[model samples]
Target: MTHVLILGANGQIARYAIDLLLNETDAQLTLYLRNANRLSNLQSDRVSIREGDVLDLATLKEAMESQDVVYANLSGDMEGQAKNIVKNMEKTGLKRLIFINAFGIYDEIPGEFGKWNQRVIGQYLPPYRKAADIIEDSDLDYTIVRPPWLTNEDEIDYEITQKAGPFIGTVVSRKSVASLVVKMVESPGLHVRRNLGINKPNTNGDRPAFME
Candidate 1:
């Protein structure tokens, strides 16, 4: 069975991914978080929860051992945390990763949509880009997922863009993002070495439809 470590298990996207993996695949999972007690309700034989921070080398190193894949859904000083993950994974001989980054990390969004996003989240873009750079520079086989504004929806449909493409679509469902992550974990070859942008299909606007 594929062994997976989810580094930010308490995140909404990570939570959805945990449920999907448990229900749809035979993979075993270890959910690592600062406060894993928040996920006590999901405790099961196939799922193990550990309380830890990604920045703690010893704790993270122990968590990475023996895992086939590392899926990181994280925020805050992203570049630094990503640095820690890269170092630990290198130490553990783990190479596969699924990193959740935000849209505009490449400043690829265009037109009014681009301007809107900048106005909304200009402050967060730099650190996110720095984190993406760290992952890109590493030897690890990684899929960097750059998702647009996320929503809570049941729909699983999304369109994808490679890094250089003008990032399209406004808001994609968090479930769609998680679904893709689980698909990658199951297949293990879905989007290796690619930086992907995900968005709900048929969506286009200055801002997410939900905002209006």
Candidate 2:
């Protein structure tokens, strides 16, 4: 059975992905986050919770041991986190990494929506871009997911674009991103070394519909 380690396990998308993984696959899961009490209600024979910050390299390495995949759902100081993840994963000899990141990190979004996104969130893109660069430079088999404005809708609907093209759409459901993550977890080779842009199709506008 695959053993998956989830960093920032309390994140909204990681929570959704955790549910999907438990329901759809038999993978053993290690949910790593800063606080255990937040997820104390989560109990399963297939799950374990590790409480520590990603910046804590000793704990991060301990969690990576014997794991088959690492899925990171994180924010704030992502560049530092990426460096630690890469350092430890390389030491542990683990290869697959599915990292969640925000859209526009690559200046890939086009048109008015892109401009709007920059105006609103541009201040936050530098660290994310540096994180992406760090992961890309590593030898690990990694998939960097860049999701556009996210929503809490119950629906699962999304499309994907590679880093080579302009990103499409303005928003995507959290459930949709989780579904994609579960898919990759189930099939490790799905998008290795690729930067993926995910969004709901045809929702393009000056901003996310929810913001309008």
lDDT of each: 0.92, 0.96
The most accurate candidate by lDDT is 2
Off by over 4 Å in 2: none
Clashing residue pairs in candidate 1 (N, C-alpha, C atoms within 3 angstroms): none
Total backbone clashes of candidate 1, pairs 3 or more residues apart or in separate chains: 0
**Tens digit of lDDT per residue, candidate 1, span 56-154?**
999999999899999999988798899999999999899999999999878799889899889889877999999999999999999999999999898
Tens-place lDDT per residue, model 2, 102-199, is 89988988899999999999998999999999999999999999998889999999999999999999999999999999999999999999999999
Candidate 2 lands at a TM-score of 0.99
Q: What is the TM-score (0 to 1) of candidate 1?
A: 0.98
Highest TM-score scorer: 2
Kindly report which residue stretches of model 1 are placed more than 4 angstroms away from their true locations once superposed.
Answer: none
